[model samples]
Target: MLKTAILVSAMGAGLMVATVASAADAALGQKTFETTCVACHGAKGVSVVPIYPNLAGQKEQYLVEQLKAFHDGTRVNPIMQPMAAALSDADIANVAAYLSSLKPE
Candidate 1:
């Protein structure tokens, strides 16, 4: 019984560590946006060109899935494929969070 409790506690702590390790930091995301995405998708995730989609006010999960698609090569856009390739999963999440947090202008 005591061993079961100890094992459960250890598992819970491991899960917590994994969760924190995977968490995204939006501050880092802002830098990433300026460096990589702001050209096509503007500073606030709006696109000046009609061909480009505006990302401001997009849902976080939707943005994450789109990034995943690009990263996985499931979606094919020359710019996005390369950009996504360079991003880690946390980067994708952070960027998604940043975009979603923005108000549409």
Candidate 2:
């Protein structure tokens, strides 16, 4: 019973840490977007060019899947394939979360 209590406490602490880390990831994503994505996607995930699709308010899961697809060559885009290749799974998730959190016009 003592061991069970200890395990439960440890699990709760781990969950808290995970939540904090996930929050940090969104911040990182925001920074990444400002530096890398703003050139095309604009500061708020709206595209400046008609050719580029706006990213704001999209579903997080949809962005994640599309990014993963670009990274994996399942989706073909000369620009995105190379860009997404540089992103890790965590970066992809973070960026998706940040973009999806924005309001669309």
Candidate 3:
């Protein structure tokens, strides 16, 4: 039916909008990383410190989940917990997208 078709089209449009917003936020994420994460994770997502895990080439979903866990105390890490605590959901998504898009060395 035309009504069903319209609903599907609206859903697809909504997805497209979300995709565009996420892409825009990825740029914001890079800035945030430079300001906050580069000290540990490096500019390319490779950590200069062996103790810090390299974030390059990670799955976006996994990164999002881990960040959420770190924020919520489901995963315990002194550093990450505090770091993630400062981030909003959008920030988490943005950073995860940016990190996951990188190629590992």
Report, for every candidate in turn, its global Cα lDDT versus the true structure. 0.87, 0.86, 0.86
**Model 1 deviation from the true structure expressed as Cα RMSD, one decimal place:** 4.2
Candidate 1: residue 67 lDDT (0-100): 93
Can you write out model 2's per-residue Cα lDDT over 1-105, one digit (the tens) per residue? 999999999999999866754563677788887877888888789998999999999987788889999999999999889888988888888898898889998
- Per-prediction TM-score to the true structure, in the order listed: 0.76, 0.76, 0.77
Worst 10 residues of 3 by lDDT: 17-26
Per-residue lDDT for 1-105 in model 3, tens only?
Answer: 999999999999999966754663678778777777889998789998899999988988789889999999999999999999998888888888888889987
Clashes of 2: 0
Q: For candidate 1, what is the TM-score?
A: 0.76
Per-candidate clashes come to: 0, 0, 0
Candidate 3 has which clashing residue pairs, if any?
none
Give the TM-score ranking, best first. 3, 1, 2
Top TM-score hit? 3
Error of 1 at 3 (Å): 24
User: Which predicted model would earn the best lDDT?
Assistant: 1
Better of 2 and 3 by TM-score: 3
